[model samples]
Structures are given as C-alpha cells and as structure tokens.
Target chain A: MPHRRSAFFISDRTGITAESLGNTLLTQFDTLEFKRETIPFVDTVEKAQEVAARIMNSADSDQHRPLVFSSIVNPEVRAAIKVDGALCIDFFEAFIGQIEGELVQRASLTVGRAHGMINEEKYDSRIEAVNFSLTHDDGVKLKDLDEADVILVGVSRSGKTPTCLYLALQYGIRAANYPLTPEDLDSPTLPKMLLPFRHKLFGLTIDPVRLHNIRTERRPDSKYASMDNCRFEVNEAESMFRQHGVAFISTTHKSIEEIATNILHKANLKRRF
Target chain B: MPHRRSAFFISDRTGITAESLGNTLLTQFDTLEFKRETIPFVDTVEKAQEVAARIMNSADSDQHRPLVFSSIVNPEVRAAIKVDGALCIDFFEAFIGQIEGELVQRASLTVGRAHGMINEEKYDSRIEAVNFSLTHDDGVKLKDLDEADVILVGVSRSGKTPTCLYLALQYGIRAANYPLTPEDLDSPTLPKMLLPFRHKLFGLTIDPVRLHNIRTERRPDSKYASMDNCRFEVNEAESMFRQHGVAFISTTHKSIEEIATNILHKANLKRRF
Candidate 1:
C-alpha cells in the first residue's frame, strides 16, 4: 500500500460544481495520487462538521486536520469546516469577489448550468438520442462490434448513435450501433448483421406520429419524414423485432436515461457507472 | 427552469461508484424532468443526511420526497437517509449484501478496476510513453493553430488516445489528435496533418529508453521499438517542436488526468470537470 492521500469535494450549493471542478483538478494530479470523495449539496454547520470529521478520519497522518477542496458559498459553513482544521480549496474564493465587484458595476454575467448541471444535460441529450435510436436500429455494423457492450438497432432517426456514445462515455460500455436502413425494414427479419450477436442486441420503437414530427425537423417535405412512412416503419420494425425475439422499447414519451436504464434492467445487466 | 424533481447518489465507498451508478439510473425518468446531483464516496449517516437535505431543498412538490439512489456500504448511513425520508436506491441496498452472502458458498467474486489502486503505475506508463512519443510529434502541428482548446500529438504507443479521450470525456473539450509517423520526423518542421492546427497543438514526449522497452513487449525484435531508432526520432522531434516555439510535456510518469490538466493549465484554458 502506498501512502494514502485523499481530497474531499465539499459544497454549500449541491456539491456538483465543487465535484466537477475538483474532479477536474484531481485528474490533473495524475502524477500525485489522491483518494477522492464528493460530499455534495450540504447546507448546514452540523453537516459540514460531520463531513469534516469523516474526511479527517481518512487522514491517518493527521488526527486533527484534513485537506478539503471546498466550494461552499455560505460563510457559516466555511467557518464550521475551518474549526475542523480542514485545508479547503474554495472554488468561488477567486471568482466570487470578482463577480460581486462586477455586479456593483452591473456588468452582465452569464451563469452556466450548474457545474454539475451542464454535464448532466449534455449526458441527458445523449441519452435522449440513444432512446430515440433504439427504434430505428437496423444493426448494420454488428460484425465488427468489439467495443460495444450492447448493440442498439433501430430505424433512421430512431436514436442509436447518441445512446451508444452515452453508454460508452458514461458507463465505459463500448456501445456501437448500426442504423436500420429501408432494405432491412422491407424484410420481415432483423438485419443479418445482428444475428451473430443476438444475445447483446436491443431495439427501440416510437409512435410513428411522434417520430414523424421529430424527423420532419431535420428533413422536411421528404419521404423519410413523411407520416405514412413513419407509421409503416414503426409497425414493420416492431413486428420484425418480435419475430426475431429482439427486445424493444417505445421511446414515445420516455427520456433517454429512462429508456437506457429500462433496457439495462430488462437485459439483467449491471451498469458500470 | 422546470419544476425540479430531486435525485441523489450516495455511497459508503468512494462516491464515484455511487455517482456512476446513480447517474445511470437518473438517466431514466426522462419525463419527470428531475433535478439531480451526486454525493460520491459518502460512507456515513452524517454524510447521507447531509446529502439528503440538498435533495430536499431542490424538490418542487411537497407531496413528493426526492428520489435518492445511493450506495453507502455502511448500514448506518443507509438507515440514516431512510429515516430522513429520502427515497434511496443504491448498490448497497441492491447488491452488497448479496455479494457478502455469496462469499459463504463461492470463491470471492471481484468486480472491475474500481477496486484497484493502479493510478500511480498507469501514470508512470503514460509519462514514459509521452517522452518516447516526442520523437514522433513534428512541428507541422504546432504552428499558427489558435482555435484548439488543446492539441495532443504523439506516437503509436505514446498514450495519445487515452490521454485525448480523458481530456474530452472528463473535461468536455473537443480534442483532435494526429499521429506522428516516422517519415515526418526525418525532415519535418512538423507533420503536415498538424500544420493547420499549429497554435492549438501540444506535444507529448516520453523517455525514448523506456519506450523502446515498451515496444519490445509488443514485438520482441521489431525495428520499430529499437533503442537507436527511438533515440534518433526523439532528438529530431524535440528539436522541431523547439524550433517552432511549441511547449511540451515529458509524460514519463504522469496520469491521463494530470497530462490533460497540465496541458490545459499551461495553455491558460479553464478545465471542465
């Protein structure tokens, strides 16, 4: 066991900003190893003190003090942690004063999604894309899909690539997908590309009516986004999946995360996140 | 802007696991429009309650207790959160006990890398690869390129892919990389592939001596991993970078996180966690 070093990301708001910024900093110290923990969205002195003690407990070298990278905005919370002798690196310490000064001058400032919030939104977008993709997955690249933990098959614009990437980036699952082309939909079977990996295959479906609206956004007045085509594909695709014993999900109203999780759960797979 | 339905991820071990798992679950409930945050590596009741309040504060409806999915290993922490009225779902609640129970009949089962402390060893590998790759990164990529958040140029085994992926995945930066072929090192200012992205480019160099040994592992007697060739390439690459005012890092003992951050910090760019 090498010498143990750890850092705590403590926050007054929700700890998301603290964690994101702190985690990013910790990632930089790859040369110097440190154990990391995030204690988020905490708002009180008692809570802060308790978190301080837990962090202190992790520091076998110091009984009375521990190093903490804190981003608590409240003055009192900061005071409480100080009593614990924590070496906190405040995220806003350098920015707040500058921002307040600017506020006095009334310079316009753009607040981003919460430090944690932005990543979540980006991830959510990917998830939304994935869920939407399941219905349209036609399984084109199933043969060379070494990296994908699972393969999503669906039709055009049914949302596969974004979900695959989401699974890859978020859960470290190598998820590759192929779109369902017209030929595959014209046939009564799942694409032959998926037959070799039937065990890992999953599908997504949607209300043709809803999908038509989504597709129309990208390629309006085209047959690809036409309502009749959307309905035919949805019905044919659902039957094809059923005939082939492939599991599918309706993405009509579900969010990507919901769709992905539901699929993961149904598949009896444990998420790596 | 939506009514914030709250979500939580708590853990007894490093909250990273909890967050990772929680993030996957939170991906579900797309229609619910929830507000979510993670409390990573949280191990105590005090910590759980601490995170619980953050969830409570963010909730929009009085009738709904925030949905919390956590993995605190300590029974005490889980119990504490339960008493506080946060709807908690976690790996501990879902699986730790099952793992313990299984230990009685079966050989101990192990999960993946989260259980390991290999950061230091991996960092060393990355750094060593960096120094070695410098022999390959020509000045072609380092000139006049200003739009790059960061450019990572290296060789076949120089750890460029992992490093680049880490930078983008962890930091949300659009990192583009091009390999330095041996041909570029002989007469190059830099590889032409990189010439267009010059100002944004950063070179990753590693100890040629270490790299030769690494290459030898993959191919026992290949000319590619030879010490003489590595040394010759290393000298030319470093000189090319210097001639073009390209600042570089010897990644002979750094982690992906560290290398990326150093590049970001050195470039005066803000890090995204």
Candidate 2:
C-alpha cells in the first residue's frame, strides 16, 4: 500500500496561497496520498508554536515527517513553525528574499495583506459584480446587459451559472449568463435580446452525454434531460455561436476556473483583481 | 510614483495557482506597483515562446525586466519561457525537485491537472454546493435545512451572501445564509426556525456604518438603509447570536475569502476541496 501522509497549509491569513501552491505541487506526485489541513491566521508566535507542536505530533504518529507549506510573513512566527520532524517549506522565506533582491527593496512583512480587505475599491467592486451576476443570472434581468464585461450564452446545464459566478468572484468581472432556451435554440438566429451585445457574447457547449447526465440529476425522466434534446440544444447553440462570429468553448470536461479563464482570455476582458 | 513593473503569471492550465502565489508574493513589496497579466494555457513549447516574447516586449517597453511567475510542468515548455530580459520565477522548478528528494519519488510531469476536472466526484460536489447555496440564499428555501454544513445568519448587507458563495465555490461547503429581517431583529431571541440548527449556525456582523453604506446603495436612504436601523439590526443580531451561544465573526473589513475561512475554522467544517 502507498504511504498516506499528512500535509499542513499554514499561513497568517486565509492560507489560500499556501494551499494553492502546495496542492499544485502535490498533484505532480500522483502516487502519494495526502490528508491535508489548513491552519490559517497563525500570526502570533504562540499560535505558531502550537501549530508546530501539532505538526510534530502528526509526524510522530504517522512515523513520517509531514510536509508543512507555510506562507507566514512574520519572521518570529515563521521561526516558531519550523518543527524538527517536518519538512517545512516556507514559501515567503524562499521567494521573498529573491523578490526583494530583484526589486531592490525590502519586503514590508505585513500580515494578512494578500487576501485581506486592503483595497476597498477592488473589494467593493467584486461584491458589486457578484450582485450583478446574481441578479442577471439565467436571463433574469436584461436591462443592464450593457454593463456586463462578458455575457455567457449557453444551453441549460451547459455550465453557465457556475462559470459566471466564478468569473465574478475570482476576477471581479461583471459576468452575466443567459441560458439558450429551447425556443431560442429552435430559432434560426441568436436571441433578439443578445443582438446588440454580440461582442460580449461567449457561448459554452457540452457533450450531449454530460449534459444529459447533469440535467438528469436536477430533473429526472424529462425531455430536458433526454439525450436527444441535449444534443439538439448543444448543436443549435454552437451553430448560432459560429454563425454570429462569437467565440465559444466546450465545458464538457473543464472546471469552472478553466471555463471562466478561457472566456476572459477570448473576450479580452480585464480582470479587476 | 513607484516603479510600475509588469508581472506575468504563466501556467499550463488556468494559471490560477500561479496567480494566487504570485499575487501573495507581490503583496509583500508594498512600495512596488505591478501591472499584472495572467497568460494561461501555455502548455506547448510554441505557446511558451510566444509568452516569452510577450514578456520581452513588456520588458523593453517598460525599460525594466518583467517578473514571470510560471507553474508550467513540461520541462521543454518551461525552458522555452526563460526569456533573457525577464526574471522567470518557475514555481514548479523551484520546489518539485525538493519535494521529489523528500518523497523519494518522481513527479508525473502531467499538464493541466491542477485546475482541470481531475476528480469528477469532487468537481460535481462543488457545483452542487454552488447550486445549493444559490437556491438557499437569503433565506429563500428553508427546506432541507439539515443538509447545510453551516448556516450563516446576519443582517442584510452584513456580507453573508458573498461569503456563502465563496465558501461554496472555494471549499465546496454547503453554506446557506439567512438574513435577519427587521421583525426578527426586533425580538430579543433567535429566530425560531434557526433554533434547531443552533449548532450549525454561524453569525456574521458588520459595523453599523459599513452596513448603512452598503444598504443605502441598494435602497437609497430608505428606512432599511438608515444608520439608526442599521445599528439596531446589528446590535440585535449580535445579541441574539450571543444568547443562542452561536459563533460569529465581524465582517466589517474582511474579504469574503477571509470571512469564509474564519467560519470554516470556527465551525470545524472539513473543506471538501
């Protein structure tokens, strides 16, 4: 059996940065199984020492030194988290000096700046974008269509809502998603509401099998979930996108991050964050 | 004005990991301003060379070396991005070897695994959580209340909705947020509907000034957006949480990521992703 190991993502703030970097690194080692935990807001030396002791305990029980991915900015807190038995990978320590050298300046060593409410304007804009996306979701509100940075057009269950939400939350992009209903798909042209904003339209299509499965989970034994209907909807959506010179992508096997980034890239939308 | 250097986050997939790590690192240098660009989907040598040329052009235009933070897994593609005029900080190259040495195993050298749909079950749950949160948002659906991992209760505009969305999107936590209406806040006790789920209940409170400002933007000086009403709502809500023995956090100056992580840490909820 492969050895199961414990991994800790420790940081002074949300630990999101440590988790993202650490998870990406761990994904490269597919053979290893990891039980991961995030310990956030470890800004004080006392908290850091407590975390160090906890990591040491895990190492003792697992009989293997656990991997510690830390982004603690305080030198004192960083020093306290260096457990003897753990492979402590201090991200800030590893790169901050290099960055400082390159930038010809010293790091501020401020804690909680990465994911904190440091920029009120940016943060408020993100919240505003989320509200905008929510209100305009699934063609709910069309009056403010011109305000959207990008409008995603797709069939039901082709992964539009989640992608819009991700775009708004991750990038502060005002993304409004419009579902291509059966009536709209049956027509030979794009929806009349979307005509003026053709440049903002980005289509998402999915494999008929995947679309059918996704719809079945929501409403079983319905025409909406039927394979034939799913195929027709996707085909029509793609045809409309191509006919209108609109850029589109398949969301069949893609994560929301992938779909959102692809739309931003294709649409040339600036990410507010 | 501080030196406005160009920083590029390059990766094989969505470049989210690169952006997250690179953003955190850049935040440490408070004196420097970065014009950041994310170049995602650089999976091939040809694409890598293109990005390298782009970085070189940025360097030439800015009259300074651009900072490139790449998480490209392909060695050949990684090599292609090593432009002469830019400082390439390869995240994978810097840490993968160290991890391999510690684990005594080789990396898979796989591309597009970090943010791709690698785990269908995990990805499905995340999408499901997003749907669940949306349906249950703003006390919309009270049925299936027991299914929530954590139910957030707060006054309207106390940062519950965005925090719930972030929890669902980032951690796959089935977070349902309930707004404390004026009538509910008028009483000195917790809402009867939330009584049974007290253990699963988390509260969010914001400063009265912040709440008033947020509400005024929506309602434009209505009674609900008045400063006096905002203070009353927040005071009553906090009292109710205290009387009910529910854990709560202040979201006055917090980002959604910080608020969500704090709730998860306090609730001891395991993040699904």
Best by the TM-score measure: 2
In the order shown, the candidates' DockQ scores are 0.01, 0.72
The TM-score between candidate 2 and the true structure equals 0.98
- Residue B246 Cα positional deviation in candidate 2, in Å, after optimal superposition: 1.1
Residues A15-103, candidate 2: write the lDDT tens digits: 98899889889988887899899999999999999999999999988888899999888999999999889898988888888888889
lDDT of 2 by residue, B1-273 (tens): 458899999989999889888888898887778999999999999998898889999998888899999998899999999988888898888998999988999999888775574566776888999998999999999888899999999988888888889999888999998999999988988888888888899999999998888888889969999999999989999999898888999988788888889999999998786
TM-score of each: 0.48, 0.98
Per-residue lDDT tens digits of candidate 1, residues A1-273?
A: 543466677765435445543443343234445666666545688987897678767765633234466665566776677534455555445344442342233222212222233342333333333333332334443445654567777787675644454354344455567677778889997677677787887888878887797778669999999999999988898898899898888766543334555565566554543
Give the best candidate by DockQ.
2
Name model 1 segments beyond 4 Å from true.
A1-148, A156-159, A165-172, A205-222, A225-235, A249-266, A269-273, B1-149, B163-171, B207-221, B227-235, B250-261, B269-273
Q: Report the lDDT of model 2 for residue B268.
A: 98
Clashing pairs in 2: none
